[model samples]
Target: MNYLELYILAAFFVTTYGNFLDVSVWEDNPEECGRTRFENTTLDVADYSKARVGQFPWVAMIGSIHPDNQILFFCGGSLISKSYVISEAQCGRLGQLVRLGSIKAEDTEEEKDCDECGECALPPQDIKVRKQIFGNDCSLNSVQRIIILELEKPAEYNDFVRPICIPTDAFCHTSRIRQRALTPGFGHIFSTLVGVTERKEKFDDMRYVNSAIVTQEECNAIYPDLLKDGEFCVDYPKGVNHSCVGDTGGPLVEYLKVKGVARAFLIGVAKINPLICEAEDTAPIVYSSVCNYSEWISNQIVSSIEAERKQGRRLFAV
Candidate 1:
């Protein structure tokens, strides 16, 4: 009623919200270091200056929007299709900006040629939302177009790095045997983690992290339990990293089909990194399984693509 009464109510709301862990704990990660799958390693890897797919371009997302649209603060995303994009539903809630086709990714090179087109290269694919779906609650994206991309049969969630890729006859294959999948994201260099490692090399410090798809075994080692029922995983004996932060909603693809999505996997999701980073040994990164939900994934991408078609965007026909 009065100014003092209003102040009391405001204070109550502030206190309530302050104690809320509702905010994603992911910030404690890349904010202070790198995203989960993308461990802050001292290994001198690839250069981010190139635009590649199934690797970095597919795994990154856009950052908080900028009023001036010159250089966008991009996150990470996975290219699931020529039209669809996937990432954590939470990003939508956090006011995170997600423009599927617009993303260049963590290690992308600026060129007009890097669009999703023929397989084995980035598709000249575009991103346009048609029907967005949420599973649990209003805790999902603000965008109403979201549709559920779930397994044929619903399953428990895993806190792992699972990504999804849109599938098309021209864009995918059925074989599960995989290798050197790509993943990427933008975050602090390994230097951000001061006392986390014992690598005694300086050159290792100059590397930029890129995106690539990895095997489930490689990734599951960090958090074995993350490979839930509906979810699937992949590994790269050659160091295919898991989908990390700035990579939420990105695709965890295999050849072509959209498989998993990137997220912390806390609220009912599998903990992709069971151990996350326990041993310093040279082990591979574990990725959350996406293909396991082939049925659900199919429905999701199909629905999304069809919607896109209606909106004037050409989509791959199953």
Candidate 2:
């Protein structure tokens, strides 16, 4: 179906069924279906730098409870629907919340400093994560380790907040390989090639690095045990750019031309790699293939909604 039709259908399902929202309806739409674009916008994926304020509305900053009784930007995540945020199994805990609509402030190290960064302020909706499911089991570094978080309430769609499209299995397995994609996150920004010159301070905006998908053979050589079925690898261009500590669980999205329109698709989830920040050209960065676990994600969302309906209250799955 077309973009408009898909949106209407999705709304209808939520209204009529009140629990079961068809995940495939929007999945079939163009990748740019729910994004907010402005005229005269210029994006440079090659150089790789901080993103515009609202350039990626579907991106969310995950906040997990710390031992000090404060919330922190534990990891990155992507908003897949009004009620779910797709993240990595190890990145977020079950009781944490995800922040949307605003960019993370630059040069902010603590939560107090974030509150003063006016434009980077968070949205009012504090959607608590009601349930967290990592496919069949919480196996780290695997596609099955995708964490599907059910928000306590449905997020309101707007210019500053939106959702990205999840591709079908065919699209991920056949089409996305060997394609150029953007990996955005709040990771560390290294000045020189050595250690982090600007460490601990978060960027004022989302940082994006361009990467090209590589064949499984190339990645398999580096990660013999980690590279498995339903997982893919990307190669960072010859440069000093790559994902850092805070980038894991973030979206690895690719833009495609659908009927003369540029659309975005969530192809994979960024896996943790301490060595990748300094790794250069042809260095393979692994990601959990999103398309491979599409079935498990949809099933979890549907099942969570059904459970919430039956219980007549919110439920948190351990």
Candidate 3:
């Protein structure tokens, strides 16, 4: 092909696929990696009030707008990048908007000033679903949704807002296993003296549980079918709290020590296991393994940008 033809093809490729790697702000100096939290504690509890403010910066609430114009929380999600959220496919069903910088459930109500933090509250940022679920692979069935939120403007990062790293399989294999990972979301506490009874109403105060990674054999035993590719389970044995309803699509995060400092990375996406979650004895809480789909997650982010660029070109051509 002549130089002119080659130029045209090159231009087409660039216009069709915007350069995402060059534009993403996810890359930062290693020293400045995880700086969104205020406090770090060794306590093991499920209470949101005890949680350090801005502890889970990537934790997001997926919301839906009611007819009366009020927003309601339906499921939880994790901000993997500035523009992408990784969540369970089921939670993306009514997903319309995503709110960030909230440590409490009631913080979603309105943007208010935090006297202690000395900064005004951040409002919920709107987002769009960029990619659908992968094809009928039962093994990867748990990884259901990827939403690309529309940011009105670039979000200002402070101590309360930051993105979490999506870990590759290599990272998990080398450093993630056997480490305690934290899963945070809002849900009800159930008590079962006679039967499963709701001891407390689901509140907005974020609740969390620290889960330990379990072997594939232990995870598969909970279900009749064998564990599929890209899936694993975490132990939430008796007396150990597990994720329940209202926390779907939330992240299973771990702080991997790098150079003696722990940096947080999203390791799993919480999945439903009604029997295990309720009983809290034998069965384990299943998670859609993030390490298995690390490549797919990267592709979706880039591909989504490409799709958007192509659409823009079409509109201009028209």
Candidate 4:
């Protein structure tokens, strides 16, 4: 089905069966963020590989509906809270519809595609955007190319949909150089052909790449004058893996143990790179650092609630 059709179908399910859906507005709890029951056990494979169902609970598919009613999924994002998502500023105006809890991008049914192991995820949640907040210095050349999206309504957290943790002060201060990170998205599997008339094939199921954070010095060596204060670089140990087209605005996360529990922490927002998935050129992907904007994010969330309250809208804790 087309994008508009899929959205209409999703709305029908919520409207007709709203009472039976396992829906609840999650409280804003740092400890609870980034905790997921599903474990991705396919780490031994190549860095570029298909993600298992429910592997990345915070990954969001950002799509825009055209005048013709066709939907184009141009970017990926991460759910930072029940009411907010973090993505690249470039994706801010492109689309507002956010799809969560599905590994297969084409699955329009309320319930996502089940795996061979009989593992099934909860129905995908399609949320509309209420507001878009761009970073103060967001621009193509700027390192702070981040955008925050406020959902029309709070999302209900479940086994298939959850939030990833923003970096705490403690986590940011520690050395992160050479630390491994994962970036999941429903990006195109192949590089765009310059003169080809046919459309490029995209990943039907979302895929993730395993890469490591490189030191600023290492990043500068490749792209001098590109590495800035609010950005970091990531590169796969094996040169074949790289973020492709449609992967922009997705989260670059690190799995770390916090208080004796392993959680995925948001480290960066995938920056838009002109050179993507080129086999010959293995340039590290640059991402806007999330740690640098933790304070800004907090302030925006607070300000949003205050603004809503002034307008007399009943706001719940997120």
Best by TM-score: 4
TM-score of each: 0.40, 0.75, 0.71, 0.81
Clashes of 3: 5
Best by lDDT: 4
Model 1 residue 160 lDDT score:
20
Model 3 agreement with the true structure over 1-318: per-residue lDDT tens digits: 345433443354345334213212222212333445543332364332324457667777776677887776666787754555667665565667677777666444555524244544465455544344342342334333333343323344556667776664457567445667776776522111122223234554665666778877666676648466777777643454334633667778776554545667777877654444456334566777776666565554445445667788322110
Give candidate 1's TM-score.
0.40
Residue 302 lDDT in candidate 3? 48
So what's the TM-score on candidate 3? 0.71
Segments of candidate 2 deviating more than 4 angstroms: 1-33, 39-44, 67-69, 105-125, 139-143, 188-204, 243-246, 278-282, 314-318
lDDT of 2 by residue, 7-121 (tens): 5445544553354323433343323344565431224456557665556778877775668856655567888777788987776543387777656633233442122324343
**2 or 3, which is superior by lDDT?**
2
Give the per-residue lDDT digits (tens) of candidate 1, residues 236-264.
23342322222333333222111222422
Instruction: Supply candidate 1's per-residue lDDT for 159.
Output: 14
